[model samples]
Target: MYPKILICDDVVYSRTMLKNILDQIGQYIIVEVENGKELISELLKSRETGAEFSYLFLDLELRREDGISLLREVRKMEPLLKIFLSGGISLTDENIKKGIDLGVKGFVSKPYKSKHVKTIFKSV
Candidate 1:
């Protein structure tokens, strides 16, 4: 089966851009969520159905939820999941370190670029 790639971003434009970039790389089932609650719900549903996403690109500044908190919960449930973070704000070294501490595989700064997308895919 084609691998599923999950994208959790609050911005519609960002999600579309990411989906388009990933589509250029390979065939993948790209799942999208606009908030933390949907992110959790989708992950749980996927796990139960044996359709867990192969990669997750999460926005650092999700609406109404702390990304770090959400990441912690996701790590608890899916320790092996490959996760990456993205944000409009420039990623500080501290923020990157925090994500790394939480088991993030990589980070992609917005707006999405072919090179950044390619790098994350390769790293994962």
Candidate 2:
């Protein structure tokens, strides 16, 4: 079965680009969200239907909210979920340390890299 991916990024262009690559891979169910707020809301709503996403692809900087907060909240709610951080924003060593501290599965710097993403999802 294909792995499911929930992609949360504020930028339309970025989301579209990521979608194209993931679609080509044909091994992932990519669900796109505009930001952390929307992602969290969808997650809560999905509980009624008992649906869950397998992988999370999140942007660091977002419109009106930050992905880190969502990450933190999700960790608190579902600690075992896999997460892949992606965006133009670069986390400092300190920030990376903090993310590692949070137990995030992976960190990906964007403008989307198809090969890297494919390699990554394959390994998982």
Candidate 3:
């Protein structure tokens, strides 16, 4: 199975920033989507091709859909998926708990930093 990286964020700049960081670290095939619908579509397409994401960088706040809801659906499909929440807003404890309950692996706050990215990769 080919390793994939999925990035779901409504903000173009956020996706670009993360992509740049990933590109700097290695040659990864990163995919980007602006909404939950697109995210689902991409996941399905990847699955059909016998591929799974090594990690998913999902934004908590999308333009039209909540990421957590999508996360629930995705968890059912890829139970072992590595998911990281991202957003400009600080996640409350309750929300963080909710994410954990839904099987998210971690959170990546906005204004991306090298250290945060490094930590996530190190775990892998």
Candidate 4:
């Protein structure tokens, strides 16, 4: 079966862009969530169903909550989930360090590129 990928971003365009990039790289079951609540709901459902996503591309700043805070909660629930931060602005060193400390696998800068997405997908 194709691996599933979850993308959490407030902006619809950002989610579409990332989905497009992933589509170019390979076939994947891509799911999009607009905020932390939806993200958590999906994660919970995945856990209950035993169909957890293989990857998550989470935006650093959501409309309601920041990704770091959400990451903390996620770690407590799904500690082994592979997460990548997607930031539109350049992330501060401190924030990056915090994310690393929290178990972020890597980062994908805004305006997603197909090449970079391909590399990340292949590596992991």
Top of the candidates by TM-score:
1
Q: How does candidate 1 fare on TM-score? A: 0.95
Better of 2 and 3 by TM-score: 3
Q: In model 1, which runs have C-alpha deviations exceeding 4 angstroms?
A: none
Candidate 1 structure quality by residue, lDDT tens digits, 67-92: 88888888898899999989867377
lDDT of each: 0.89, 0.77, 0.84, 0.87
| Weakest ten-residue segment in model 3 by summed lDDT | 86-95
lDDT of 3 by residue, 12-41 (tens): 988999999988777788999999889889
Report the error of model 3 at residue 55, Å.
Answer: 1.2
The whole-model C-alpha lDDT of candidate 4 against the native structure comes to: 0.87
Question: Candidate 4: where is the Cα deviation over 4 Å?
Answer: none
lDDT of 3 at 36: 89
lDDT of 1: 0.89
TM-score of each: 0.95, 0.87, 0.91, 0.94
Which candidate, 2 or 4, has the higher lDDT?
4
Residue range 47-96, candidate 2, lDDT tens digits: 66667778788787887876677779878866777887776655667657
State which candidate has the highest lDDT: 1
Q: Write the per-residue lDDT of candidate 4 for residues 4-117, one digit (tens) a residue.
A: 999999999999999999888889999999999999999999999999998999898787797888989988888899989888674678878988998888888878887887
